[model samples]
Target: MRAIQITEFGGPEVLRLTELPEPAPQPGRLLIDVDSAGVNYADTHTVENSYLAASSLPMVPGAEVVGRTADGRRVVALTDNGGYAEKALAAEHLAHDVPDGVADGQALALVIQGVTAWHLLRTCARLAEGESVVVHAAAGGTGSLAVQLAKEFGAGRVIATASTEEKRALALELGADVAVDASPEDLTDRLVEANGGRKVDAVLEMTGGPVFDASLAALAPFGRLVAYGMASRVPPTPIEPARLMGRSRSVIGFWLAHCLGRPGMYHEPLDELLAMTADGRLRPLIGAVHPLSEAARAHEDLRARRTTGKLVLDVRA
Candidate 1:
C-alpha cells in the first residue's frame, strides 16, 4: 500500500508518499481500504508537531477517511491515526455507513466537518431559533458546513468571516446572511452591523489569536462562544474573566476527537447529519481532490489557505 508518511515534523515538505505494508484491523476494529482521505487544518498542525496529539515519526497523518470495510460496505471512520494511506484500521464503533446518495469524496468531506458543525450548533453552543450566529473561517471545511447547519437549525441571521472576497462570496452562497472580511480591524464591527446592531447569540470560532478577542467582543449577553481550532497558529491569549462576568457570556472549547471518545455521543448526531446530506438539505463541498501520491501538495494547499471547503486525497487513484 502507498501512504503519506511524516518522517519528521516541520512543514508540508515533511509529508512523503511512499510504499508501505498494508494495515490490518485489530480486535473491535475494522480494516478500511481507503477510497479517500479528508485533509483538515489540524493535519497541518500535526505535521508541524503542534497539534494536541503529537505524532510518532514516520506515521501517516489524517483523521477522517472514506473507505470500505472488509465486508465491502462503504463507510467513513474517524481514526486515531494512519488515515493518509491506502489501507487503515478503524474502530468499528467510530465507523458509519456512507449513504448511497453521497459520493465517496463528499461523504469523506462531511464526516469530520459535518459532525463537528452538527455538534457545535446542536450541543456546545445550543443555537436557538431566531438567534444570530457568527462563523469564522466561514469558507473553510467546518465553517462552510456550519453556515448551512446554523440556517437549518433556525438561526435568524448568520454572519461569516473570511480572508478573501472569493471566500466571502462562498460563505454567502452557503446561506450566510452576511460575510465580513476577516481582517483584524473590522471583523467585530462588521458582524455587529450585519446583525442589526445586535451581538450574536452564538459564535463558532476556529481561528484564535486576535480574532478570538474580537469574537468575544461580538457576543451578546449570555452568548456562547465555541472554540474548536486555532488555525491562525497563534498561542491562546488571556481572555478577560471580567468580560464573561460583565456580559454573562460564556466561552467553551470543543474538540470532536475528544467528544467522539464518549460512547454513543457521536452516533445520533452523525445519523441526523448524514440523513440531511442524503436528503440534500446539507451538502459537503469538496473543493480539492488530490491523488494519494500528491499528499504533500495537498498539505501545502491547506496550510497556505489556498483551498476552501474540504480537501480530500483520492487513495483509489
Candidate 2:
C-alpha cells in the first residue's frame, strides 16, 4: 500500500509518499479499499501537532475515507488510524453505506465537514426556526454546507462571509440570504447590516482573531456563537464570563471528536445529510481533487486559502 507518512510535526513538506504494508485486521475493525480521502483544515493542524487531539509520530494523516469493504459495500468511514493510503482500517460502526446517488468525492465530503456543519447548527448552537444565522468562510467545505443547512433548518436569515467576491457569490447560490466580505475592518457592521441592522442569533465561526471578536460583537441578545476551528492559527481573545452574562450571550466551543461514540450524534445527522445530497437538496462542492501522491500539494493549497469547498485525495490515482 502507498501512504503519505509524516515522521515529524511540521508543515505540508513533511507529508512524504512512500510504500507501506497493508494494515492487518483488528477486532471490530474492517478493511477498506480506499477510493478517496477527505482533506480538512484540521489535517494541517494535525501535521503541526497543534490540533485539539495530539497526533503520534511516523503516522499517516487523514481521518475519513470513502471506500468499499471486503463484502463489496461502498461506504464512508471515519478511520482511527489513517486514510491516506490504498488500504485503511475503519471501525465497523463508524462506517456508513454510501448512497448510490452520491459520488465518492461527494460522499467523502460528508464524513467530516458535512457532519461538523450539521452538529454545529443542530447540536451545539441549538439553532431554532426563524433564527438569524451567520456563517463565516462561507465558500469553504463546512461553511458551504453550513450555509445551505442553515436555510434547510428554517433560519429566518443566513449571512455568509467570504474573502472573495466569487466565494460570496457561491454562498448566495447555496442559499445564504446575503453575502458579505469577511474583511475584519468592518465585519461587525457588515454582519449586522446584512441582517437588516440587527444582530445575528447564531454564528458558525472557525477563523479566530479579529473574525471571532467581530462576530462576537455582532451577536444578538441570547445569541449563541459556536467556535470550531481557528484557520488563521491565531487564538481569539479570552472571554469574560461576566460580560456574557450581562449581554445574555453564549460563546460555545465544539469539536467533532467529542461527538464520536455518542448515540445518534454522528450517524444520524450524517444519514440526514447523505439523504439530502441524494435528493439534490444539499450539494457538496469538491473544489480540488489531488492524487494520493500529491498530498502535500493539497495541504499547501488548503493552508494558503487557494482553494474552497471540500478537498479530496484520490487514493486510487
Candidate 3:
C-alpha cells in the first residue's frame, strides 16, 4: 500500500510518499481500504509534534478517513493513526456507516470537524438562544461548521472571522450573521463592533496565540469561550483568574481526542451531526481535494491558510 509518512517532525516537505505493507486486521478494529482522508490542523500538529497528545516518529499523519471495511461496508472512520495509507485500522465502535448521498470527502468531515463543531457549541459552550457568538477562523473546517451549527442552535447573532474576503464570504453564506476580518491584531475590536459595540455571549477560539487573548477580551459578561486548538503553533497567554471572575465569564477547553478518553461524551452529539449532514442541513464544504501523492502540497496550503473549507486526500486516486 502507498502512504504518506513523516519519519521526523517538521514542515510540509517532511510528508513523504512511500510504499508500505498493508495493515492486518485486528480484534475490535475495522480494517478499512481508504477512499478519502481528511486533512486537518491536528494532522499538521502531529507532524510538528506540538499537539496535546504526543506522537512518535515514523508516523503516518491523518486522523479521519472515509473508506470501506472488509465486507465492502462504506464507512467514515476515526483512525487511531495510519490514516494516510491506502489501508488503515479503526476502532469498530468509532467507525460509522456513511449516510447515503454524503460524498466520501463530506463523510470524512463528519467524523472529526463536524463532531467537534457540534460538541463545541451544543455542549462545551452551552450557547443559548438570542445570544451572540463569535467564531474565529470561521472559514476553516471546524469553524465553517461551527458557524452553521451556532445558527441552528438558535444563536441570535453569529459573527465569523476569516483572513481573506473570499473565505469570509463563505462564512456568511453558511449562515453567519456577520463576517469580520480575522487578522489577529485586529480581532478584538472587529468582534466587538460586529456585535453592535458590545462583547459577545460566546466565542469559538482555536488559534491560541495572540488571537486567544483578543477573543477572550471580547467576551461579554457571563460569556463563554471554548478553546480548542493552537493552530498558530504559539502557546496562548495565560488568562488572569481575577479578570474572568470580575465579569463571571468562563473559559472552557475542548479536544476531541480528549473526549475520546470519555467515550460517553461523544455518541449522542456525533449522531446528531451525522443526521444533520445526511439531511443537508449541514454541508461540509470541500475546499480542496488532492490525490494521495500530493499530500505534501495539501498540508502546505492548509498551514498557509490558503484554502477554505475541508481539505481531503482522495486516496482512491
* Candidate 3 runs further than 4 Å off: 261-264
Error at 219, model 2, angstroms: 0.5
lDDT of 1 by residue, 58-128 (tens): 78888888888879999989888899998999888889998788888777767788889988998899988
> Model 2, 1-317: lDDT tens per residue?
89999999999999999999999989999999999999999999999999888899989989999988999999999987588999999999999999889998898889899999999999989999999999999999999999999999999999999989999999999999999999889899999999999988999999999899999999999999999999998887889998799879999999988888899988998899999999999999999999999999999999988888999999989
RMSD of each: 1.2, 0.8, 1.2
Q: Which candidate has the highest TM-score of all?
A: 2
Per-prediction TM-score to the true structure, in the order listed: 0.97, 0.98, 0.97
Clash numbers, per candidate: 0, 0, 0
What's the lDDT of the predicted structure labeled candidate 1? 0.87
Of candidate 1, the 10-residue stretch with the lowest lDDT total is: 258-267
Task: Give all candidates' CA lDDT scores.
Answer: 0.87, 0.93, 0.88
The local lDDT score (0 to 100) that residue 120 gets in candidate 1 is 92
Clashing pairs in 1: none
Candidate with top lDDT is 2
lDDT of 3 by residue, 265-289 (tens): 5666767777888888988889899
Worst 10 residues of 2 by lDDT: 234-243
